[model samples]
Target: MFATKYRVAGITALAIAASVSLAGCTINMPGSTSDSNGMMDGGMMGNNQNSSGFSGSDIMFAQMMIPHHQQAVDMSTLAETHTTNPELLALAKQIKDAQAPEIEQMTGWINNANASMDMGHDMGMGGMLSDSDMAALAAANGPAFDKLYLEGMIGHHEGALDMAQMVIDSNNAEAKTLGENIVKSQTAEIAQMKKMLAGM
Candidate 1:
């Protein structure tokens, strides 16, 4: 019994020593950074806050959504041309007027930026409409157009909100502030659209 107890104690001590050795080995591995550098290299610390991932989330959301808003405006304009209903035409006009100026506002910001950049919508985060979605909008009219428009725009706004949050999370002050503004404005607009959809 004493031999058995001594053997178990020895084994336990060996195991602990081995674990400690392994931990030190891991920390001292060649070119393996410790602290923040280790966190950075491991992609375990967090995404960069200053680089692409660190850059303002607002700019990212806006650039991607600029083209998206332009597409919506274009769809609204087309709907106005094909529809005879004053209610629908007026709604389409409102969409065009509101989005056209926003598109200009965003593009002007980009043009004024210190660098030129593009967010390939292929990245899956741009929140822009797919080609099929635009086609669906193109074929819709009257109440149908309004329904599609509301549904699609709601989704579009949600996408912008999603991208905007990324900027906020990344910790860019300007981006974060703009992202908050977008969230507030868009959430309100989405509620308004729900009411409009219900009326339709």
Candidate 2:
């Protein structure tokens, strides 16, 4: 009878140990409820291939940049009607072409991650034109418009470069790649715009 009692006790101990191990594993699992909720609270998602590798900063980078890029695209569109300068027109088109695709890509990343598109605040994004500034740009024409466009875009590109630097060292591969591209392309465009401004 004592032997049988000891055997039953051994079995009970083993069952308790197994339960404890499973509880620990569940807590650490990638898609665990607690862990996932925490990530989501920080503007990140969990369990999906696209979101699994993203950090909070990666998600924030994508979220904030989408609107910033959209504003650039809008500014470029304004150039079509406001400027007849061939160089200004061409540069405007280049900015639109480059940034429009990037906006779409960043949107896709946010959607895939199940993050909100809205950043819920201005984020103090540098170089964004105020309503009055945009109104002035829209009202100008010819050489006046060209001057404003070059100056505005140079500052805008510089702002983007600053934002990109935040994500350049991201652990997420996609975010890092995009950040590097922004730095490279915008740096070149900034130099080009400065030269155009000087010539004008």
Candidate 3:
């Protein structure tokens, strides 16, 4: 029985390895079709071996990023509730508008992947914020608040970039698309934030 199991595992690996040579590689794995149009093929699927849903790396990336994105949105929300500066308020609204949809998208991916919703269950990085961090942001005001907010947001964006790179490094094709997008978006945002911080 053990020998038979090993043989099955070896065969599975062989099949997967062989599929690497197929055209439109990233989104197209064997045992899958791209619908009526050939153009719709693997480009969208990202070379997945499993048809049921997301790869493990993809799931991990989604779970971790959801909370990380949420934190950025959450911090931004604080500015609306707690600040008076028009400039700072505008920044807060921008962060909230941008990240809120991203949080939803990540959440949808986690659900679609058949992954657990309880981020507490070792779901990577989407855990709740610490009480102290919340208080520090809450108490800040004026340029001091703007400086802290920008600094804090930069760290938050860095965390997202780290998790995104984790997905890219894993080479989960479908997830890599999302990961690459995150890298592009956050890197730009981080640079922008730094410029704002320097002026402050």
Candidate 4:
């Protein structure tokens, strides 16, 4: 009877330990809470990518940056038709080339998290240009266009760097990798643009 009781006790202990371990794992993963009515905020859905180890910050970074990079690509497209300066043209091409792939990559990250990409109109952070500013840029041509493109893009790149840095603590390996790449590449591009603007 003593031996049977010992075995039962051991089994109970193992079951309790397993439950505790699973609880710890659940606590460590990112999670969202719903309202008392059980309705979850749309942003919360975008912020939680626990399946991929992504935190809220990682999701925010990717979402904000998608529109921001799209703006850069749009501005770069303007430069193609509006500017005569070879340097400005080359820089515009480079911006589009680098950011297009990044935009796609960030989109994948957001989708992987099952997050909504439609983050609404006010998603602008860092140094995002106003719509009026973009309109003015579109209206410009020749040296004026070059000047505006260089200045505007420098600000845009700064914003990207800011977004990337904000997600530096993400546990998601892919998000972290993209963030690091943005910091390194955009920093160099920003410096190069500064030099070009000064020379012009």
Whose lDDT is greatest here?
Answer: 2
Q: What TM-score does candidate 2 get on C-alpha atoms?
A: 0.76
lDDT of each: 0.53, 0.66, 0.58, 0.66
Predicted model with the maximum TM-score: 2
Q: Is candidate 1 or candidate 2 better by lDDT?
A: 2
lDDT of 2 by residue, 124-158 (tens): 25566778777888999999888877788787776
Q: Candidate 1: list runs displaced more than 4 Å.
A: 1-58, 84-91, 124-127, 167-177
- Report lDDT (Cα) of residue 154, candidate 4: 79
- Tell me the tens digit of each residue's lDDT in model 3 across 1-200: 11111112222332332233222122334444557644323233323424435654455456556766777787888888676877668777877787788778767766554446443432223223456766887898777767777777776666566556545754445566777878897788778878887886
By TM-score: ranked, best first: 2, 4, 3, 1
Instruction: Give the alpha carbon lDDT tens digit for every residue of 52-140 in model 1.
Output: 32232334445555776777687677777556667657666776777687777656544543223464332323334567767877887
RMSD of 3: 13.0
How do the residues 1-200 of candidate 4 rate in per-residue lDDT, one tens digit apiece? 11111112222332332233222112122355556743243333223446655655566666667887898899999998998888888888988998899899888866665666754433325556777888999999998887777787777776666566655655677877887888898899889988998897
Q: What are the runs in model 2 whose C-alpha is more than 4 Å off? A: 1-50
Worst 10 residues of 3 by lDDT: 1-10
